[model samples]
Target chain A: MRIAFAGNPNSGKTTMYNALTGRSEKVGNWGGVTVGSKEYPIKEEYTGGKEVVAVDLPGAYSMSPFTPEEGITSEYVRTANPDAIVNIVDATNLSRSLFFTTQLLELGIPVVVALNKSDINEKEGTKIDVKKLSEKLKCPVFETTSTEGKGLKDVISNAIELVGGGQSAPYVQADINLQNKAEVDAEDRKRFSFVNDIVANVEKREMLSSETTKSDKLDGVLTNPIAGILVFAAVMWAVFWVSQAWLGPLVADWLVGWIETFQEWVAGKLENSPAILSALLADGIVGGVGAVVGFLPLVMVMYFLIALLEDCGYMARVSAVMDPIFKRVGLSGKSVIPVVIGTGCGIPAIMACRTIRDERERRATSMLATFIPCGAKIPVIALFAGAFFAGAGWVSTLSYFFGLLLIFLGALLIKYITGYKYRKSFFIMELPKWKMPSLKFAFKSMMERAKAYIIKAATIILICNTVVQIMQTFDWHFNVVEEGAENTSILASIASPFAILLIPLGFGVWQLAAAAITGFIAKENVVGTLAVVYGLTAFIDVDELEMTGGANNVAMATGLTSVTALAYLFFNLYTPPCFAAIGAMNSEMKSRAWLWGAIGLQLGTGYTVAFLIHQFGTLFTEGHFGNAFIPGLIAVAIMATAVILIGRKTRAHFDEKYRLHRDGKSGAAA
Target chain B: MLLNAEPGKTYTVKEINTDDEEMNSFLFRLGCYVGEPITLISKKKKSCIVAIKDGRYNLDELLSSAIIV
Candidate 1:
């Protein structure tokens, strides 16, 4: 039996799926989550006949295909031809949920209504006439409390009974579905008249109750100019708390333990064969991408929490709440998606740019996405915190803040430069209901994101590592230095030019410098590169912390003070993202010149900012600022001024001077 | 005249009279899009902030010109 569960965000679709299928779960990358369908099988014990494959598709409110989730869900329902579909609906939000039920019925299938969240509905004084709704739709409906394990047997049994029964649900097909869709196919125009009619009949509660209007009461203040700003700040604080305090360190600790075990096992296996062993364990795989992959647990945890909030619809709530500030910056609230997700990984975050269609806004989005320090680069920040900054959580927090600050400033710069003067852009978005996100949904989502990360590590990261290993095996200085020398190795030969570039960022020493250059290919390679050059993988164990180069190995690697380390983290955070982001630019722009232009823009912005920091940041330490710092601050001020002005220009549509230039073309026609 | 269509001025939609023939038909075809009223959040050089229903939208001059209100 092929059954599909479909519904909107927070509608208990996944909770119901997990309840039905338990631990026998198999998940793959469903095109970067947000709108991917996950399928699992349930073996029938007594029947001993057929296996039912049930697919749980991403949730959406309507079948309009506005969001990617809507597109994937509606397409599967229409074409997949499942035996039965359980359209899970939030019982408390029946009026809105029925909007999809009406659309699902239009697909000519028997959709059994799984009225989830019934537990919360009764508390909220909501009543659903499921029997009446079924009669109205010409199908069976069951009230299910997936969280509390209520009504699953009845829902499943009804699903099994309805399968292959060839029944149609009670749905009003447009009496005149654009008879030609070309001429006077116009009545297809009455989009929500059906929703209005169905709700008029089904809604037991006519008007929203006072207590039910809490969102509005809250929004009045929350979305207010001042209060809304404060609320946004508080919410950001919560996000940071959730990311760093609640999840980051704990996951890192657990992952590091596992990595240590793996490293030891690999070391034992490769003891005699240095070339073969180092290539396979250190340079080829682990040195290349293993270090980054070790942090998968933390990355997955972060993505898991994000998915939970996204599934339950709180992220959208944030969008609605922050609409005002976004407007001032010439972005709608939804533009913040890239910013929020960008903090995780620029690659997926850049791919998430698929959600934004406007060319100018998308460019603006990409520019800011690079500014958000991703998980791959977070190690640099943490390394600084642990080694130099007394492992102060606050210093780690400041690096993130620095990244976000740059993003804001960068967005303003984009607004100033483009004014999106030529192209058109618009934002029309939907806000889903808020509910408790399911652990099943969160787990599935985390696994999917990790799958993508894994694929990346295996392919691009592994290949980059192999190339670094192969080249470093050769002597670039005409073999003047011996093969096993400390500082004159082949890796150092390739890293010389870029080493000069990092001098401005401070701590531009050859090894730290080389790590930065290799990081452009993939940020995760830095640690592996460090391990290879410094011989940290086998020579020194973390437990021993033995002497190396007249100092502890950890101390030797981390000799830079906190301020310098923080500066390194800041510079890396703001620098051009990995080459994958460069590839993204090429694909997005579809112009070679434009790609190079974007690269130039990223490099210029990164170097300029870091240079400003390097030239004058000495003031913080020595209490005396440099003359070189003055120009950099001037550049920052000038950029800020341009953004403020251009922000105004973007907010107001087509001023007289620009309009005159636009109409000037038409003037020639006149 | 389209209400609040001043060259530089922007305004929030307070009351959209469903009786406006052109605007009503246009929005309806965009799919029950009437409940979501738009606020002319700002008017800069060549862009505008439109608060549509619950979401705030940024529309450029070309797209904004197509929006009747």
Candidate 2:
């Protein structure tokens, strides 16, 4: 049997898919789009055992084929003709969820409605006549809680039975062309009204109960300008506390133990220059790759916490709190989801921007999501914190703020400086009334995400690491360290030109600079580069040199207070994203022009910000020294002036919605 | 106006399938679809936020272009 799962964003469809499929699914894209799909096998023994293939198409509101995701789903439903489609709908928000259902019905596929988040509706004092909705849609409806595993078997079993029954398939016109689509849709409010009336007849509710009321009360205060900001601050503080206090020490200790046992075991077995020891132990495995592996704990812990908040629905609140702030900066709150998700991974973050319907806003959001310090870069921040600065959280925080600054700068530049622009897009979304989160779901999501990160590292990053090691280990003519370090190491030569770029950042010395260079490939590789660069015993134990009293060690050492450490962090956070993100942008924007446009903006932004920082900090600190900082300072000023002037010229044109009156523009009314 | 109609008063969107073309570009796109009752959820600082089915959408002063509460 072939079954496709479809739903709106956050309708608990993914949660349900994961719950039912367990670890049997693979997450990937369809053909070209960056949107991820989950596919798994479903087998049942009835009379005789046979297997079913279930594909979880990307979550989308309508099969309009407006976006790549919707297009892929529409194609699947129409052509592949899945044996059945389980349309997962959020019970609490039936109106919005039903919009998709209405369209799905027209597709004429054998539909089964998984009425998810039923408790959310019940708590809100609402009751849905599932029988009626099922009758109206002409399908079986199962009121379910995907997270709780309630009604899962019934939902899928009925789906399988229906397929087995050989029910005559409903015929839906594959493509209902909307010629003069905009005008026709505009004229068809009654069509939408027809569905609305159907919902009114099928659903009834009183006022929300205490649990629902409490969540609203919390949202009321949590969304209040002053209170919400405070709440946001508290939330960030919690994340920091967990990251610094919990993850830092726990990971360091564990890695130390793992490295010690392995290091000694290797030392005992290998001779001075055993080929295996020289290549896999030292170069291929330990040198660069081990550094990346060491930071896996940090990445996993941070992602786990982020994923938990997202599933529990608190992440939406965080984005809401920032709406007012974002709007003022010419960004919508929806764009913030991608930026927030960006802290976990850029690829998904870029994909997440699919919800932004406006082309300009989506593009802008895509441009900036990479600016957020995705988890891969965490080890870089921590490395700088440990090596140069005395493990100060301030460096980490400054880097984060720099990430924000670059996003803000990119938005401003796009809004004013060029033809690239966005008409103000509204921030609209369902705020699922909060419920007590399930720890089981959170842990499962965490493990799944951490596993994806590890697998990608093993496949993609390992290949790159081997190539880099081979090149660096070779002395041009022959392999110096081992046969593994052949004359083709791509990294060492790549790291050469960047030394010129890093000169002003203090520790631009090639080895240190090489670590930063590797950062652009995958943030995880920076830690690996450092381990190999200095021949450090373990990735986390760089502080072993701190005990030495020599001026050179201390001078060369970087701990929290060093401005250079902060400066390096700034560059990494603000710089252009790696090739994977660039590839994602290429696909999403669907144009080489837009792809290059985004990359150019990132480079321009990074160079400008880093240049300003180094020049100004030097001017302030070590006395406005010689020719060191002046030219860079002037170049920075000119670039800044150009961006500002361009932005001002376009500001007036963009503000058709708001006219500037002496003080401020007359913005949209309350 | 249903005595329930006041500028800031919250109303559950009861069957709002209106033939309002001018509104579609702004009001409708912001999750203000029919039966997804929106409350004048809040009037913070400068504008109001609306609650619509599992979500809350913020609309500023220019909502005058589409909504007439």
Q: Which candidate achieves the best DockQ against the true structure?
A: 2
Model 2's C-alpha root-mean-square deviation from the true structure amounts to: 6.3
Which regions of candidate 2 deviate over 4 angstroms? Answer: A23-37, A43-48, A60-80, A121-133, A164-212, A272-280, A419-424, A456-470, A479-494, A539-561, A630-670, B1-38, B51-65
> How many clashing residue pairs, candidate 2?
22
The stretch of ten residues in a row with the least summed lDDT in candidate 2 chain A is A24-33
List, residue by residue over A14-63, the lDDT tens digit for candidate 1.
66776777742322111123445778775464114457777888766566
lDDT of all predictions, in order shown?
0.59, 0.63
For all candidates, what are the clash counts? 12, 22
What value does the lDDT take at residue A224 in candidate 2?
A: 75
> Which ten-residue region of model 1 chain A has the weakest summed lDDT?
A24-33
lDDT of 1 at A93: 61
Interface RMSD for candidate number 1?
8.7
After TM-score superposition, the amount by which residue A557's alpha carbon in candidate 2 deviates from its true location, in angstroms, is: 7.0
Q: How is the predicted docking of candidate 2 categorized under the CAPRI scheme?
A: acceptable
Give TM per candidate: 0.71, 0.82
